[model samples]
Target: MNGNRFGRLFQVTTYGESHGEAMGVTVSGCPAGLELSEEDIQRELDRRKPGQSMITTSRGEPDEVVINSGLQDGYTTGTPIGMVIQNKDARSGKYEPYVTAPRPSHGDFTYSAKFGTRNWGGGGRSSARETVNWVAAGAIAGKILDQHGIQVKAHVNQIGDIEAPPVSFEEMLEHTEENEVRCAHPPTAEKMRERIDQYQQEGDSIGGSIYFEARGVPRGLGAPRFDSFPARLGQAMFSIPATTSVEYGLGKEAREWTGKDRNEDWEFDAEGDPIPEGNKHGGLQGGITTGQPIYGEATWHAPTSIPKQQKTVDWETGEEKEIQVVGRHDPVLPPRAVPVVEAMLSLTILDFMLLGGRINPDRLDGTAGEYDTEYHPSSPDNE
Candidate 1:
C-alpha cells in the first residue's frame, strides 16, 4: 500500500501479500552482464523460508524463486529484475477468526485503524513473508558486493538471557551457518534451540538479539550530516518487520562510559597509518566507514501470534473476547532475521557506496577499488 521501494541508484520495490498468490520484487539499476541465476537467489531464500528446523514455523513452502524478467542468458540486463516465490503452503483459513479481532503486539490494530479495513488473512502486508523479496534482492546485492570482497553476515547473539560468548567476525562466518539457530557457538545454539522448543510446546513465543557484521567495506562510503551511513542503515533495517531496536558499534552500552573510556584512541603504525586501539565506534566515525568490520545488533519482539488465548474487543459488538492465533509463526524471530539484517546491511552499504562515489552506479559490474588505509582491531579496552 505504498512505501514498498528502497534505495536511490540501486532500488528495489517489493509487491504481493502474505496470503497472496505470490510475493516478488522488481530491482532496477542493476548493471547488465552480471552472472545471475535462479539458484543464486533461491539459496538465500531457502535460508529465510519457513520449516527449516524445529524452532522455526512448520509451514512448508518450497520458496522456489522464479526469475521472470531482466536477465538474458544467465546475466543481468541493466533493467528491472523481477523475481517471485509462490505461497503454496499458506494457511489462510487459520486466520479467519481474527479478521475482527486484532492480535496483540501485531500491526493489525494500527493497520485496521488507519485503513478502516484489512485483508485479515495472514497479517496481509505486515507479515514476515514480505521479507522474502528483500532476501531475493539482497542476493543480487551480495553478488555485487562480492566482486569487491565485501562480506555481510549475521548470527543470533542472544536469546532471552542466554548470551553466547564473543567470537571474531571470521569465526562467525565460518560457524554460524552450521546450525539452524544460526549461532556460532555450538553450546549456545543448542540451548537456544532447546529454549525455543520448550516455548513452542507451551503455545508461546520468544525474542532475541541478532548480531551483524560487514567486513571489507571501504572507508568514506557514507554521507555526512543528515544522511549519515548509520542513519541510512538504521532506516533500512527498521523497515523489516519486528525490528524494534538497532545499535551500531557498542550501541547503548557506550552511554555508560565517560569520554576517556568511550573515545577510541588512534595511534600511528610504523608507516604512520592511523590504527584504532578499540572499536568503540563500531567502524564508523562521523557517519563514514573506517575500513574496519562494522558490527551492530537488532532486537526483535516475540511474535504476537500464539496458541495461548489473548483478550481483545470484538469490533462489531464492542465487547471483550478471547482469541487464540493458530497460524504458524517463529517462536523466536532472530534466527529468521539473520538474513534480513544482512540484506539491509548490503542495501545500506551499496547505497552509501553509490552516494559517496566510491562505486560507479552506471557500471554496476565494475569494482569500487580499495581504501589505502588498513584497520587492525586491537583488544577493546572497555569490553
Candidate 2:
C-alpha cells in the first residue's frame, strides 16, 4: 500500500482496489495554468476501457474520470490533482470460486504469499485494471510533453504466433487506431483479430508484443546509473501485470549482433544539422535521450484467469481440482495494452523531464520560471 507512488518530481500516487468503490490517482507536481479537462483524460480512458471490442474484456465500465480537485476553470491549479473513476460494473460475485484457488500466471499465489491474503475479487491491486490510473496520469504528463512537441505512441506488433511485417511509425500512427486490434498493418490486424476471436471462443487468452515509440524528446534527460531513462522506464513498464519481456535498442538480441551491424552513426540532415540516421540505438545512448525517436517493445504473457478448465489446488480443502475461472477478462492483452505501454512511457518521460529541469514546476508564490539549459530538440543547432 505504501509503494503506490511513482516518480520523484512529477509524482503520481494511486489508490483503490480492483473491485473497490473506485479507482483513482493523485497527480502531484503538475504545473499550474495547464489546460486539463475531464474530457482530455476521458479520451485516453476510452481507449483503455473494456468492452470496446470483442477482442478485449467484455466488462463495460464507463471509466468516466471525475476530477475531484486541483482544477478551476478547466485549468490546473498547482495543487495535487485528484481524479477517480467509479467501478460500477465490478461483479465481485464471479470471484467466489477463486477465494482459495489461485489461478496460474496471475498475482494470486504470489500476492497471498507476500501479504498473507489476497483480494481474489479480480486480483486486487495486481489487476491490469489498475493501469487506468497510469493512463490518466499519463494523459496529464503527455499534455505537458505536448507543449514541447514530445509525443508517445504504441501499437500491437504481434499476437500469439502472428507478427506484423515492417511498418513505418508514420503509418502506424496513421492506422493504429483504425483497427480494433490497435495494429498498423491491416492484414496483420485482421489475422490478430481472428486469432483473438478463436481464443475467446475456446475460453482462453493470448499474449503478444507492442512496439512503442516516443518522438521529440530532448537530449540528456536521465542520470548516468540508477536513474537512467531506460532504467526508470523499465521500472514503470514492468509495474503492469503480466509484462514478460521488455527490450529496447536491439534488446536481448544485441548479444548476437556485431557492433558493425548494431552501431549507427549520427548523420547530418540536409540542413547540415545532426540527426539520427537510424534507430539502432532506439533514440537512447547510455540511458539518456539522443533527440531521436525512442522506440522499444514490451511483451505480455497471456491472461492468467481464463475460463478454460485449469489445474489448481483448492486451499480450502487442500485438494487438487480443475476450475474454469469466471470473470471479465480479455482474450488478448497486447492490443489493449498498447495504450497502457504508451501511458507508462509518457509518465516516465515526463518525470525525467521534470527531474532534469527541462520544464518548470508549479509555484504557488507566482515565481516559476526555472530554465535549466538550452538543450531542446528544436534548438536552432539541431534544427
Candidate 3:
C-alpha cells in the first residue's frame, strides 16, 4: 500500500483495485501553467486500454480519463492533478472460485499471505489493469517532457524469440503504432502477431521485451550508486507487472565483450562538447546522464492469468485442484506495454530533470502567472 507512490520532485500516487469502480492517479509537483486537458491524457490511455487488438485483452473498459482537479483555464494549477478512469468491463464472478484456491504463478497466494485477504476479482490490486493509472500519470509526465523538447518512444522489440533489427529513435516513433504488435520493424511485427495468435489459440500466453529510448535528455540527471539513472529506470521497468529483467545499452551482451571493445572512446561533437564515440554505455557514465540518447530493454514474463489448466491447492480445504484461468487475457504483453514504457521513461526523465534543476520545479518557465509564453496552453479564443 505504501509503495504505490513513485518519484520525488514529480511524484505520482495511484489508487483503486482492478475490479473496483475506478482506477485513479494523483500527481503532485507538476509545475503550474502548462497546457493540459483530458484529451492529452486520453490519447495515451487509449494505447494502453484493453481490447486494443487480438493480442491484447478483450476487456471493454473505455479507459477514458477524467481530470477532476489541478487545472485552471486549461493549464496546470501547480497543485496535485487528480484523474480517474472508471472500470466498466470487469467481471469478478470468474475469480470467486480462486478466493481460496489461489491461481498458480499469480499474486493471489502471496497477497493473501501478506494481507490476509485480497479483492480476488480479476486479480484485484495485483492485476496489470493497475497500470491504467501509471499510463495516466505518465501522460502528464509526457506533457512536461514535451515542453523541454525531450522525446521518449518505445516499441515491442522482441516477442518470444522473434527479435526486430535495430531501429532509430525516429523510426520507433514513426512505425511503433502502425501495427498491432507495436514493433518498429514491419515484418517482425507481422510475425510477432502470428506468434501471438498461435499462443492465444493455444489458450496460453507469450513473453516479450520492450525497447525504449529517451532523446534530448540533458547530462547530469542522476547520482552515483543508489540514485543512478539506470537504477531508477530499472525500478520503474521492474514495477510493471510480470517484468523479468531490465538491461541497458549493450546490456548482458557486454559480458562477452572485452574491456577495450566495451569502453566507449570520447570524441568532441560539432558543438565542441564531449561525447562518447559510440553509445554502448547507453548514455550513462558513472551512473549519470551523458547528453546522449538513453536506450534500454525491459523483458516481461508470460502473463500468469492464462486459460491453460493448471494445478493449485485450496488453502482452507487443503485440497489440490486443476483450474483453468479462463477469462479475457492478453496473449502477449509487449504490444500494449509500448506506451507504458514510454510513459515511465518520460516520468523518470522528467523527475530527474526537475531534480537536477534543469527544469524549474515551481513552473515551466520559473516565473509565476506567465501564460503568454511558449509553454503556456493556447486559448481557443485567440485562434
Q: What lDDT would each prediction earn against the true structure?
A: 0.84, 0.85, 0.88
Candidate 1 lDDT by residue in tens digits, 35-60: 99999998899889999988888889
Top-TM-score candidate index: 3
Cα lDDT tens digits, model 3, 312-371, are: 999899999999988888888888888888888899998888777777777865564423
Q: What is the TM-score of each candidate against the true structure?
A: 0.93, 0.92, 0.95
Ranking by lDDT: 3, 2, 1
Candidate 2 overall lDDT versus native? 0.85
Cα-based lDDT at residue 86, candidate 1: 92
Worst 10 residues of 2 by lDDT: 374-383
Tens digits of per-residue lDDT, candidate 2, 70-97, equal: 9999889989999999998888898877
Q: Candidate 3, which segments miss by more than 4 Å at Cα? A: 366-383
**Which residue pairs come into collision in candidate 3?**
none
Which model scores highest in lDDT?
Answer: 3
State which candidate, 2 or 3, has the greater TM-score.
3
Q: Residue-pair clashes per candidate, as listed? A: 0, 0, 0
